[model samples]
Target: MSNGDEEGVLRVLVVITRGERGGAQVHVRDLLVGLQGRAALHLAVGEEGFLADEARTIGVPVHPIPALQREVAPRRDAAATRALLALARRIRPHLVHTHSTKAGLLGRLVARRLHLPAIHTAHSWSFSDGISWRRKAFAIPLEAAAGRWTDRFIAVSAADREVGLRYRVADDARVVVVHNGVADTSLRARPDRPGVPVLVMVARLAAPKDPLLLLQALEQVRAPCRLRLVGDGPDRGAVEDAVARLGIEDRVELLGTRRDIDAILADAQVGVLVSRQEGFPLVVLEAMRAGLPVVASDVGGVSEAVEHERTGLLVPRGDGEALRAALERLSADPGLRAAMGRAGRSAYEARFTVQRMVEGTAEVYADVARRHGLPALRRPQTPGRP
Candidate 1:
């Protein structure tokens, strides 16, 4: 704060490849907005995506790199790295901040090449979840190499930090855990109360999300209940097929990608997430904020969010039996569900607000600046920032 590095100019460039409506992208948007007036800020995201669109809407200078995409394309990825490096050269950023797996690797390497300090936030580990062993083989080693050059690694959950340390991706001294944060989304009255309780899951319909496991659990439910999936992705067709195969078509509704999530949550009695891997997910928080008890997989930072037999139940990854039992338990007991919902809301207010996320991340930024001897930190330009 008040030392050797207080008088120099410091600029931050936040980079991400996929800017679609995932947790990582949401984190970037919120971080930039929260960090407003704290430092000179810029964002480099995939060209013409939701992340860029929203960042621009919030008045951040956005540099779109077409080559920066989610799919692994060697030529396109190299081009994106070059684009980022060239942008870094022009901006002369004091620090390079990266999110997600691919951008962290490429951007951190670029930062090191230019002799600049770099900070990476592990939205989730690249090799995490249930990817093929072959993919994991290369990803783990490559990420370890990337971690070597990263000055500081911010883990979104304790689970992620452990993953890095376990893999020797980075030393414990260099890794810090900062739980993701959520804002108070506007609530709407839910009057569509079905006689049979409804379960809602808001996540992309992808393999990692494991929406299929949720369907299998529904088939095992003794009591009648309905499931509403509020998002869509590559696995949409498969998910639909599973619902048909399980003969739960009448009970399951696929309300593909929704903008009115709070409203949707307002209607549902319980929320579930069956992702095989995750960081601290924003969707879980959204469900908690809406006063809905969550039944989610106990992988990654999920245990950090939902307390077993407290706020909500945490099932083992891909365990349809455990998932079924938990869902049935919640659905059968309205009073217990309400109690869990109240507890979840209390937890959300206590530890998971956007204010905490912003201030915590600011401390990380200050830490980086101090360690780099870059500049004496300044009070935020704006008197009040949430």
Candidate 2:
């Protein structure tokens, strides 16, 4: 491992497969922001999208790896490995921290070749529950192979850590759970309104994230409620068609990709995320930070953040009737919504604050640096303290 900067600040090369706006992208962006000033950060990412834009805006050096794509192409994979190795050579980072599956595989390989410590944050394993059998078959062995090259694995949720062990991706001692976090938005209190309740679901209209399931459940909601779908993906057209076919177009609004999520949640009554799978979604924490009760599918570490009947309701994945009941119950009772929202906000402050996530990650970096014989990373100063 290269000795860090002269001042001893760890030079970390963060890698991720895509720069697209999604859970993994958001996690990377937030981690970069929180690590600012505490470390010398560089990003090697594929595609130019929100993650790249945000990293540049925050003044982190962003390296574009054209061959680093999500799909499995042997030629491109080989090229991406060469390009990443070259970049790692040039940057001479003390450690390489990778996110997502593709980057994790390639980044760790590069780190191993260079004899540098590698830390991989598994946003969600491809073989986790709710994924297709074919995908699981492909992923299990690949992850097990990559696990040997990884120095430490950071699973965003304990559930994800368990999956890693169950699949033999890593031993229990190597994987640690560091829950995702977001900036607090609790000050943007939900407004007290009298019109029909509005339920906001902020997830990409894509597979795994079943926006149509929420739409289907919304149709069964007896109470008059408007559903706002706040994301865009390949399934947008299908969701639009579902909104029309369900004949609830008038009750649903497709607000595709908005930056002002806190504002939107402030104006709404409840926040919802119905997905086939997840790995401690940041949006759930975002909702909790905004003091809005959440109704999410009970999958992949969501239960760690959302306490049933306290912070919000958790229904079985794909169960339209249960989903509808949860939505209806929250919609009809304003008092319950307000109470749950308060509890959610409290939970966010206690466990899901951005500071906690950043600190946890920094500690992991320090540990890896020490094990690799690198100098200790300077601790990040608390935001408000003198």
Candidate 3:
């Protein structure tokens, strides 16, 4: 399992369940880009989608494990485990890092079998409070078992770390909080638009994310505002039906997955996310980066990024009235929106930049290497060497 490099550069094999355009996938893509010159990187994904494509385009070798999927299929799981084991043996990376649940489970198992150090970043735990009880029942013990094999657990937020601690997934010493970050977007000064204020929510239309609730709230909104739902998922059809059912079709637009999120946010007045569960969503960070005030559900670590009454407002989950009130309040006050948007941008610059996240993660990798008596991981002395 030698790295085969005289320079002692750290070689890390990064794995994730899906290659879709989700928060976790985006995080992985950004990480690979940030760590380009700092380490030798390899990516293994369940399917060929946005992440795999982006990783390949960035010159990272992409390994496909056809059997690695989100659903729980014993046969597929075993096959995926075998495929990953083979890949790990062939690559012989210094360490294995995994994201998302399916990859986290099988990747660690493969790492343990190969006697390699394993690090897992829990984007969101299956056993979180808002998750289904059946899932929690199955996931709790399973994660605890996996935690034993994991050398380090990267929780995207302090709240996520607390969940792992409460469930005994891992001890506090083994888990670290590294908030998700996004590259800063150049802010475009918004010109005054008079007719209707636009609210944008960039999230997959899926469970945990309640686009329908947002639609219902839209129906009751007193302020003249239009809603733009970006990113598509399994629940798109249902969301469309709900939009029509609420008779707010004119007020809602479904812009399924676009690369120009920054442009869209630049034109928008506010950013919103109403989710049942989250582990510090990158969308909120993007919103902050784009200099837009957020109005998100008060769940998971959202409160960590969005300060109540400062950067934006936090409403109770699934409370349509509260959501409407928050929306209306912000819609009516142009001065307040401008002030909050400024605060959000300041917060983003101070706390959630890609450089900070990449360095924090590299530190974790260094810590793992040091404890294992492996060669030290070093960053290139020159900035932007890649």
Candidate 4:
């Protein structure tokens, strides 16, 4: 009988900066869930939201690093690094895998110090997310340094990989592209809502997400359609105000944060994402799984997920006219919407299932194990044997 220490069962320590409800957090959670039994999982994250609590729900050991924060705080970041070093010494992980930029920096640093194998996953490049020039200058150099400290990097989309290379954040030889995947939890294909077409945007109300572009496009969309903005963030007030100014108050529904994602998808005819930067968004995958045509800005990893004119329409990012035309086109054509939805569902089933994602990630772990010469399970040593 094989136990956790059995042959090929690697012990991995997964780290992320914050438990805030976001894409990177979701990536870590789903990856961990899929890796269960295949690896002995230990999760380290900041005390933020449902990430730690939900991981605990699934019986994964949770370590909350109080000093680890989303935003930069030199003192706290230093403390967080120290805490990670101590945790590494105690738990003694075979390999450290980090998600999100902050944790990626800290985790790789500690692993390098311990002379252990490690890799970082780029959910999105921090510097590419529309930060100030001063911050970008500082972040790009720091990112390069972190890349040097690690063994390999997993990019969830080709767009993400491109950003890293364009900025010289990571070397070409050390990066691999692995598209994000979601479980097939689709409900029945929704009949288009009565009165007006419902276009759903599943993203935080932040600058990178750019909900305002969607609002501006909606204002110009000739077809009478309702935009359902799901999720909230620091830019809610701006988006809300824009909604009023665009005279879309009645046509736009601000669903702050939602748990009924399936129901929401089931009611919508199309999905939209106007993020200025993204790394293979999961919402688009969810929309595909739910059999809805998507109309998203051609930004980041979105093109790789949405096949142009087949599964959805891709418009130029931040181009209000282009985005408006795409949305209105879908609103006016039910047959086009259904055809694209069907194609998207087929694509999702073919390439974006959780099982496929788990397998791809496990392969990465195996390669890391092989390179690091991970210890294999040996039969229990005879008592008193030297």
> CA lDDT of each candidate?
0.84, 0.88, 0.88, 0.83
Number of colliding residue pairs in each model: 4, 0, 0, 0
Q: Per-residue lDDT of 1-386 in model 1, one digit per residue for the tens?
A: 11222235467889888877888888888888777656667888876777788877767788988898877889998999999989999877789999988888889989989988889998878776655678878889988888888889899999989888877888999898889988786673231244789899999988679898889889999987889999889999999899999898999999997778889998899989998889889989988888889999999999998999988999998888999999999888888888889888889999898878887888888988988887644575542322
| Superposed model 1: Cα runs more than 4 Å off | 1-9, 188-194, 376-386
RMSD of 1: 3.5
Which candidate would rank higher by TM-score, 1 or 4? Answer: 1
Model 2, runs deviating above 4 Å? 1-8, 382-386
- Candidate 4 lDDT at 145 equals 89
Give per-residue CA lDDT, model 2, range 1-386, as digits (tens): 11244356688999999887888888888888888777888999988989999988887889999999999999999999999999999978899999989999999999999999999999989899999999999999989998998888999999999999998999988898899988774355562357788889888888889988888888988887898989898999999999999999889999999888878888898999999999889989988888889999999999999999999999998999999999999889888888999999989989998878888998899888888888676656556310
TM-score of each: 0.93, 0.96, 0.96, 0.92
Question: What ranking of all candidate models by TM-score puts the best one first?
Answer: 3, 2, 1, 4
Q: 253-282 in candidate 4: lDDT tens per residue? A: 999898788789988999888877778999
Local error of candidate 4 at residue 349 (angstroms) = 0.9
What would the TM-score be for candidate 3 when compared with the true structure? 0.96
Residues 117-175 of candidate 3 have per-residue lDDT tens digits of 99999998989879988989999888888899999999999999999999899998999
Look at candidate 3 and give me any clashing residue pairs. Answer: none
Lowest summed lDDT over 10 consecutive residues: which window, candidate 4?
A: 377-386
